[model samples]
Target: MPEPELRTDRLLLRRWRESDLEPWAAMNADPEVREHLGEPLTREQSDAVAALMRAEFEERGFGWWALEVRATGEFIGRAGLDEVDAGMPFAGVDVGWRLTRSAWGHGYATEAALSCLAFGFEVLGLPEIIATTTVGNVRSQAVMRRIGMTRDPADDFEDPSVPEGPLRRCVLYRIRRDAPPAARRAAGS
Candidate 1:
């Protein structure tokens, strides 16, 4: 089954299109946007990630859906669930997002992420979902909290994919089916 389109008051979360490639590459190339994610990617590397996302959607019916501003139809970035990377200690789906610099401070990540969580728990019947971010990525951590995830300091781990450094130390946050009522409401459940 194909992933169904998801919408919020101001955004549309849907599959990637060939037309999305250029902006996606530009976003990946921005050093500010890539700060916690590692070095800015070359266009080829960006394209490869997009290709992998498409393949994930094809194989699993969902991946990181390209995010768009509903009113202007602008491609902002992507937000959705993905399988936790193999090196992580956790086991289950993870929620994540990346947006263009212009799209920051707009609460779009929270809105879209709430929708993804709702789908993961309510639609897919997932028991839980987790999110991990570089310890320095406070903004993303705030978003996770806004959507009802709670972090356990004991569960923090160093990301093996990242070199031993400030960025390698990561924090894990999780939300389960029994999350708070406010959180469920945030997810539109």
Candidate 2:
């Protein structure tokens, strides 16, 4: 059987498909979405990243998911858990998401994030998962907190990938395996 699809009340988190390329590319092209991620990606760059995610699913058993709205079956964005890049401060699982501006304020990012965290902590049996964002990305930080992750002010550091400047400063958050039930709760997530 194909790998199982994770469902939240209004969305599906599943493997990417060829049909997702256009929307995925569009999302990467948005200036607002790319604000924290660097400049907008060219179509080639976006496809290459999608190809890498496919490879990750095959090799790592899990990777970023193609997020679709259940009500409309429309491509919305992506969210999931994965290992931090080698240069990142944390060495283990990290949960994250990205959505188009049209999909903002609808809770889709939070919903998808909670589902991804559930998979990492409960399904993958990970001990902990960490997340980092540019210190000023208040929207993302809010989602991290809503999901019950705690800020480790000490873990904050300059992101190695970002050139030394304002954007390099990042804040880190984490939720442990032993986190309280409410903190790890994904049922209403």
Candidate 3:
């Protein structure tokens, strides 16, 4: 099944397209965008990641959908629910987003993330959705907080995928389906 397109007032969350390659590669190559995401990727590595995203959509009907500005149809980034890797201490779907630097400062990340949370909790009937970021990535953690996820100090873990460094330490945040109405309201859903 194909992932369904999700729309917000200013953005569109949809499946990856062949045309997304060039800009996706450019975004991945940006050092600023790659700051907390590890080293800037070579074009080949970027393509491989894109391929994996596509496979996820094909297999599960949802993944990290490519984000675009609805008015201009410009590719901005990717955001949505993804299955946490089995090696992680926890197992479940997680919400995440990554946008080009130019797309920063807008509320796009929160908007798209809220939609993904809705899909996970409402549509998929998931009990909870989690998100994690390197401890140093305060910007992303802020997004998590804005989206109504609460972090537990005990849930923090060393990300095995990240090499031993400042980036290895991660903080986890979660929101359950039964979370207070205030939480969904805070996420602007």
Candidate number with greatest lDDT: 1
Off by over 4 Å in 2: 186-189
| Candidate 3 stretches greater than 4 Å from native | none
Q: How far off is residue 114 in model 1, in Å?
A: 0.5
| Candidate 1 lowest-lDDT run of ten | 180-189
Off by over 4 Å in 1: none
Q: Give the worst 10-residue stretch by lDDT in candidate 3.
A: 180-189
Q: Rank the candidates by TM-score, best first.
A: 3, 1, 2
| Colliding pairs, model 2 | none
TM-score quality measure for candidate 3: 0.97
Give lDDT tens digits, candidate 2, residues 55-156.
887788888889999999999888887788897766888889999889999999989988888787678888888888999899999999988899978899
Error of 1 at 147 (Å): 0.5
Residue lDDT tens for model 1, 1-189: 777899999999998999999999999999999999999999999999999999988899877999999999999999999998786777899999999999999999999999999889888889999999999999999999988889999999988888878899999999888877877775567
Q: Candidate 1 at residue 144, lDDT?
A: 91
